[model samples]
Structures are given as structure tokens and as C-alpha cells.
Target: MDPAVTAAALDDEHRTFARLLREHQGIVATVAASYCRDPHDRADLAQEIAAQLWRAWPNYDPARRFSTWMYRIALNVAISAVRSAALRQRHAVPFDERLHDVADPAPRDPQAEQQIRALHAFIQAQAPLDRALLLLYLDDRSHREMAEILGLSETNIATKISRLRQRIRHEL
Candidate 1:
């Protein structure tokens, strides 16, 4: 491709990606909050997810749904961010006394929110992979999509989800 053509193509792709990002940007926050306990750290994690997505945008396969690709990137970034305590501390936030605000758009229910907080606390104690699966499950990803995102067989996803659900029910 000519230099000018390549620049124009990149510009167009960036615009489209920005639009898609606006629509589904909630995934970044959702994944970040699932992994990051501090509010400011969560914000930083979201930014990292966005940066990773921007870097990976050129390789995005158009045939797949944009949200799926974005979800995969967000989760990968979230997982990486959690795996390194020093890296997270580099972006560390002093604990905020205010309740952590979720990206949920539903009408606010104090009772429901309390329950959700409890659920999140439970999830926080889970192993990394279980944490990922439960987050995907809470996000309502289909079994096939979860498998694709996590690089597991569909059967494996189903089994894991079942076990996770059982564990959540038993523990919660």
C-alpha cells in the first residue's frame, strides 16, 4: 500500500474503533473492577485495557464481533494487571471510603447493590481463572464465547461454569 493510502486507512480504522470503543467501553471498567480493588487502580486498569486494545486494533478480525474481540483484550489486560503486585502498586490508589461504583445501568437499588457487593467480595477470593470465568458468566457470555475467549473447549467451559456456579451457591 502507498504511504498516503496507508495513512488514510489507518485514520478510517481509528475512527471506527473509537466509535466501537464508546459503545462497549463498559467492558474495560467491568473487567478492571473485577480485578482491581482500589478505585484509582481500577481506572488505571481501564486505561491500560484501552491502550492495549488500540495497539491490537489493526490485527482485529472483522469477521468476529467487535465486542468479543474487545472483551478478550480487556480480560487479558485485567489478568496481566492482577498478576503483578508491583505493577498494580505502580498505579496504586489510596483506598476510597465511598462505595465502588459499578458500571451497571439498571435502576439503583440499595438492597441489590449490597448483594452485588457481597458477590464481588466472594469473587475476589477466587483463583484467577475462576475469577475470569465467573466474570464472563456474570456478563452473560455464551458458553461458546467464553470458551473462545478463554481458549478452552466448549465442554470445558460448561463444566467450569457449572462448578463455579455450584461453588458460588455453596459459599454465598
Candidate 2:
């Protein structure tokens, strides 16, 4: 490929990646929010995921599913971000008490939004990996796909999901 053509192609790929982020912005934001207690950190993590997606775009295999690839990147970013020293300096907003009030209002049905807020509160109280597992499961990713993304066996995914569901039910 010619140098100019390659550059333009790369730019176009980045644009497509940006569009993907826009389309799945809520999913990314939700995943970020689940991991980070601070609203600002969640937004920052979402932006970091977008940036990582852009950086990894050139290598993206067009034959594969875009959303799955994107989900993997988003999950990795969220998990890794939460473990960072810089992220540790930021205190988590208390989940059982005031976090729900601090959450942004949803534009959709109020009942559904309230349910989502309640779920977020529940997930925020779980372990980090458990939170990621629950988020991916809620996103409707299959056990096989979740296994691939989380580096676990399909059976393990099934078991973990079953346990997570029970745990969430118990919490609620």
C-alpha cells in the first residue's frame, strides 16, 4: 500500500472505531461506572477504553465480530484501570448509602432506570472480577464468548455466572 493511502486507511479505521464507541457508549460507560466509584473516573476510564480501541484498530480482523472485540478491550481496560496506582488515589463513592443519589439520571423509563441504578449499586459492592463477570453476563454475551474474553473455560463461565446470579439475588 502507498504511504498516503495507508495513512488515510488508518484514519478511516480510527473513524470507524470512534463510531463504534459512540454506538456502544452506554455499554462502555456502564462497564466503567461499575468498576470506578467516582463518576469522573468512570468517564476517564471510558475515554481510556476508546483510546485503547483506537490504538488497537489497525490490527482488528474485519472478519470477526466487532462488538465482541470491543467488549474484550473495554473489559480489559476497565479491569486494568481499576488496579492502577493512580486509580487507587481516587476514593470510591459509598455504594450502600449515597451513590445512587449521585448517579446521573437516565432519559429512558424511570422504572427501568431505577432498576438499573439498583443493579449498579449491587454490582459495585462485589469483587472487581465478579463485577466484570456480572457486567459481561448482563450485556448478554454467551458463555463461550464470555469465556473467551475472560480467559476461562466455558464450564467455568457457566458455573461463575450461576454463582454470580445467585449472589446478586441474595443481595437484592
Candidate 3:
């Protein structure tokens, strides 16, 4: 192929990647916020997720939804960071009170806010896999997509979600 043709191809690929990333940037932010309590750590995790997405771009299948692919990569990176941080710290991080600080313009319901805080605390206390499942479940992902992103069977995903729901009801 001519050099100019190759350059144009590369440019097109870059543009596609950029467009996809822009469209699904919320996935990165949500994953980072889900995994990291500190704002600094969340920013770092988001950056790492974006970098990994770029590195993995060449392998992305165009037939699939970009959001699914982005979620898989983002969750994997977030899980790895959580594991690494756990190994280094060898202790659980303190609960971030900032998660409770909701800035809603509408009238706030105190009881609902308390429930939300409890849910956040419950989620934070969960293991990485469970946390990921809860995030996926809360995001209204279908079991098939959850299975694909988490590399579990659809049956397994269903079972886990059922169990997690039971656990939440029992504990919270």
C-alpha cells in the first residue's frame, strides 16, 4: 500500500477511537468512581482506563457495542487497581463521606438520602467481583452483557445476581 494510504487509514482509525471514547467516557468515570473513593485515585484510575482502552483499540471488534467493550476494559483496569492497592496497603481504606454528599437541586428526601448512603457503604464493603456485579446490575445491564463483560456464563451471572440481591436484602 502507498504510504499516504497507510497514513489515511491510521488517521481514520484514530478518529474512530476518539469518537467512541468521547461517546462512552462516562463508563470510565463510573468505573473509576465505583472503585476508588478518593478523587485523586478516581482521576488516576480514569486515566489508566483511557490509556488501556487506547492500547487495546487495535483488538476491538467493530461488530460489538463500543460501550460493552469499554466497560469490560474499564472494569478490568479498575479491578486490577483495587487489587494492587489492597496488596500494597494490606488494609481496608476508610469510607469516603464525600459519596454521601449529593448536590441535588430538587428537594432532598432525608430518608432516601440515608438509604442511598447505606447502599454506597454496602457496595464499598463488597469484594471487587461482587462490587462489579452490583454496578452492572444497578446500571440495568442484561445478564448476557454482564456475562460477556465479566467473562462468566449467563447462568452464573444470573445466579450471582440473585445471590447478591439476597445478600443486600439480608444485610441492608
TM-scores of all models? 0.84, 0.79, 0.88
Consecutive 10-residue window with the lowest summed lDDT within model 1 = 91-100
Local distance difference test scores for all models? 0.78, 0.75, 0.82
Rank candidates, lDDT, best first.
3, 1, 2
* Poorly placed runs, candidate 3 (over 4 Å): 85-107
Poorest 10 consecutive residues by lDDT, candidate 2:
93-102
List model 1 lDDT by residue over 15-93, tens digit each.
9989999999777767776777666677888899999999998899999988888888887887787678786566432
Off by over 4 Å in 2: 93-118
Candidates 1 and 3 compared: the better one by TM-score is 3
Residue 168, candidate 1: Cα error in Å is 1.3
Error of 3 at 151 (Å): 0.3
Instruction: Report lDDT (Cα) of residue 80, candidate 2.
Output: 86
| Candidate 3: residue 93 lDDT (0-100) | 29
Better of 2 and 3 by lDDT: 3
Compose the digit string of candidate 3's lDDT tens values, residues 79-155. 89878945336434223445335323455589986877788888888888888888889889999999999999999
RMSD in angstroms, candidate 1? 3.2
